[model samples]
Target: MTLLAGARVFDPETGETTRADVRLDGERIAEVGPGLDGDQRVDCSGGLLIPGLIDCHVHVAFRRPEPLPRSARILEAVPVLRGLLARGITTVRDAWGADAGFKHALAQGWISGPDLLVSLRQLGPTGGLGDTWDPAAGAVDNYGDPSLPDPLFDGPDAARAAVRRMVRAGADWIKVGASGSMRAVRAGVDVRPTDAELAAVVDEAGRCGRDVLAHAHTSAAVVSAARAGARSIEHGTFLEDDAVAALANAWYVPTLSPMSDTEFAGTHRRSLRLAVEAGVRIAAGSDLAPRPHVDLTTELRLLAAVLGDAAALKAATSEAARLLRLDGDRGRIESGLRADLVLLDGTDLDVTDLPGRVRAVWHDGERAGALTSP
Candidate 1:
């Protein structure tokens, strides 16, 4: 048993802070109150204890432009996995390109990484995002890791088969392309999966006890995906009022980092404001490829620009867990929950530049990572 003493716990839900000592037993939080007793007490004075951060969308094994071998590509992501945990992210949901082997390696202590919930690959229409067919060369792009199966389909039956294939490949959730890229739509080459196909994918994933994450950027796509029973919309970039109404029972993950410099930056900001005003549950995702870096703080800071600091913090912590269906297991700093917590050096609750202030991290009641400086 261990006790984290003297830190003030910040509740993401109510935006309240309470001075308490959190007791840890094995892998769960045993108690949260004043002066909790434990065999060993770790000094946490002048610190703030909050739930460990979660990133709802990440592609750790994303293919880079340089075209490396499959083993080299996967090895390149090892440091990224370690970096994510060092930045205080205890859990992550890989949208695509990471297979079940990555998760197993982490569990078996062969690699250090955030607890992973992997989609393995994303399904889409023939000419959509996951399709690698090259008509000019009459060959498919097989540069990606073989662990990720082909992700192309045409009709509803093919879509259902694609979902089943992913489940068999060890997908925790099914990700489908509900719409084409913005550039494709602007170029008048949009080719989204049919409504029937989207519904069939959702139904098949549901039969496997999994939820669906729909990659949608347009308002029409958002409505269609929500109506098709998608649990979350990936990039609601062009979200409108009617689309917000369609997401009454769904989540919205606006991956703002990748769109910060695009021409549609202002439009994406407006969509986020609309979703916020409409009371939509919003989660922050970086949508970063492997080259630059895996940083969720940028997304959280962007969210802070729309939502206040406290609420923005919640978007990455408690709210992100809720989006991943892990609220009861490891979201808040409550008793009887997994002891996935981050201890910040400062006593105050300013989440701006959160990663810089990380002093130590605990995942499942064990000291996972710590910074050399605060």
Candidate 2:
């Protein structure tokens, strides 16, 4: 049981904030009102209390390998995991390269990290966006993990089989590369799964009561995925005018970090604003590297620059939960929701410095993350 007193709590659902005290009991929020009484109280007098953030895309078990051995990279991901929580991210949806074993470890207290929603491994065709084939390094999936799924399927039957494989492996979501990688493929963005293949994957996922998220960059790919019933387009960077309408019913997670390269910086920024103005549902995902370059704050900061403060906050919090199909369980500071909270000691609840200003964090009503000051 814990009490966070006198803070500005932002309601992601309403985009309104108010001053109140939040009381937690066991693992759920007990109450949220002005004069809530509790057994243990922490005076967050001038702080900002917000629902714990959710990152819709991350690759926890994969990162650039240098200086550290393969196993060290896995073990050393602890700090980055802690860094995520300290920065107020309490839940993460691992895009790929994470297995069910790792998710169970986070749930069972074997690891100190956020509540993990893992996709196990991304399913894609041969020589596609998720292909781990480096000319120099033969067939290494994200630094020599052969267990990662890169099944090549030419028919709808094969695609359905791949989706079932992931579902049987305890995947929470089925991640598919609907478009090709610019750097990896000679055909560039034109490399995409056929509409039939996308339909098969989506069909299998729907039958299992799981959602499918597509890594789509081009407008054509985005349109195809949305038509095929993917829950969201992971990197809908090049959405056209008509493509924007396609995403009206689907969430668009424009992972701003990776696509900020030379050819995309200005246009990608413009497309983000267009997506918003065109009534497309936008969610936040830092496609940031996991180990050496873990940072969720920059994504929010950049998102705020494009979508203003309140919407930017929603991109990271409640809206992200909706994209991950976790709206009912968490992603709010309500009385009955899971008590995943982040208390900030800062000037205000701004996106840029909100990560650094995290005063304390609570996951499942238990104190977690870095408490900079008592």
Candidate 3:
């Protein structure tokens, strides 16, 4: 048992801020009050305690320069999970990875990382963004190649088959590339899956009691995915006004931070603003991959710059947890939630400057003890 006292607790759910003490028993929050008592105590006299952050979209096995082999990618999960926890992210939803066993390992305490929620390798059509075979490299010469597992389907039947395969492989959710990606697709112009195919994937996912997350970049694709019942739209980069309204009606997640620094931000930012104004739920995700420096704090700061401070904070914490469907268990500092929290150094610090103000972090009621003074 442990007690964290004298901290300004930020409760996103109630929009409440107060000096409080939080008690932790084992891995859960035992109590919260002004002067809680416990077997062990820690002073948080100059800190602010908020819920552990959740990253709705992430690629844990992602590596730079060249894609790593399946075995190597799986092995990197330990360090990646540790890094995320050290940054105060106790939960993460991996958008794509080699397999679900990696996530199961973390959850069963067989691995060293935060609780992982994985959508094993994204599903798409033939010649889609996830189905690249470089014959010249001699790396992906066979089907189910560890280096290049084809994330492709031929049609609706194929799409349904792919969903079953993913479920059988222990996927918690299904990730489908409904449209071509600017960074992942080259030569082939951007194309979206047919309505029939989208419907089939969604239906199959529903039958299996799993949610579908769509990687949609264009307006048409976003609309199609939302209408087809996708749980979240990974990157609604080119959303239109009407599409934003539809997203709000469907309660879709409009993930916008990936394009916050891109050249397309000139147009995408406006769409994002409209989406927010239309009451569509916004979630924070760094899509942190191919670049190691992009952490949750950096993503939150970028979001604040694009949106406002309040929206950014909500996106990073409460909204993101909602998207991941973990709001009941995490995402806020409350009496009956997990004791995963982060302690920042200042109360008067600008929200835009959050990345530099992370003084300490705690996961599962234990201090991270890794962060140094800013």
Candidate 4:
């Protein structure tokens, strides 16, 4: 048993932030109150304790500019996960790049990492951004290349087959590319899958008892994917007022915070503000690919710049967990949930000052030391 005392516990779900003690038994939180008894006690005086952060979108094997060597990419996964753990991210929904073997390795204790929920490889139509061939440039490559292995499909039948392949490969969820991507190859093409194709992927995933996360950038594509029953929209970078209204009753994850530093910030900021005002369930996702380290606080800081500090924290903790369907098991400083928590050194949740405040991190009731400067 362990006790974390004299800290302000932030529970976003209940809107409670009070000075309290949290007791842990093994990997789960045993109790939370003013004072708790435990065999071991840690002084958390003058600190803030909250649920461990969650990054809803990440690509573990991705490398920027050029793909890394296969062996290097594989070896990097452990340290990447460790970086996330060190930053107080105990759970991550790997949107792409994790294969069945990699996930199994993490699950079997062969790799020390977060609780990984992966959507095998992203599924997309031929000539799509996820596809290997560049139609305009007349360049061609195999879809299964180590550098770009996100499965490509040609039609409804192929989409169904690809989803089944992912399920057979032991995927926890399905990822479908419903629209074009600005960062991937074929940047400006409208790669939205046909409505029938979108339905086929969703149906196939439903048959396998899994939810689908759709990668969408355009307003039309976002609405189509939402209507097709996609569990979440990965980017929603161009969401408009009408599009936001369309997703008012559904879950949408805007991965725009990380891209705020890019050239597209002006256009994306207006769209994001509309989406937030429309009450579309906003969740935090770093879209942290190829960085070797996943930084939720950085993502949160960007979110606070766009939204506010309270909304940014909610997006990372409770809101993101709800979108990932892990709210019950994590995401709150409550009893019976996993004791994955983060202890910041300061009282103010200031976005500009977050880098200096992340003093320590805790994962599954075990303390990990301070975060290194970037």
What would the per-residue lDDT of candidate 1 be over residues 121-200, giving only the tens digit for each residue?
A: 88999888777767786646655556677788989999988988898889999999888877776887778888999999
TM for candidate 4 is 0.91
RMSD in Å for model 3: 3.1
Q: Output the TM-score of candidate 3.
A: 0.89
Show the colliding residue pairs in model 1. none
Q: What's model 4's overall lDDT?
A: 0.77
Worst 10 residues of 1 by lDDT: 365-374
| Better by TM-score, candidate 2 or 1 | 1
Clashes of each: 0, 0, 0, 0
Question: Which segments of model 2 are wrong by more than 4 Å?
Answer: 63-70, 134-147, 184-189, 371-374
Worst 10 residues of 3 by lDDT: 139-148
Cα RMSD of predicted structure 1: 1.9
The pairs that clash in candidate 2 are: none
lDDT scores of the candidates, listed in order: 0.86, 0.79, 0.73, 0.77
C-alpha-based local distance difference test score of model 3: 0.73
- Which one is best on TM-score? 1
Q: What is the C-alpha lDDT profile of model 2 across 106-139, one tens digit per residue?
A: 7787777788877777677776766667789687
Backbone-clash count (model 2): 0
Local lDDT at 160 for model 3: 94
> Which structure is stronger by lDDT: 1 or 4?
1
RMSD of candidates 1 onward, in order: 1.9, 2.7, 3.1, 2.8
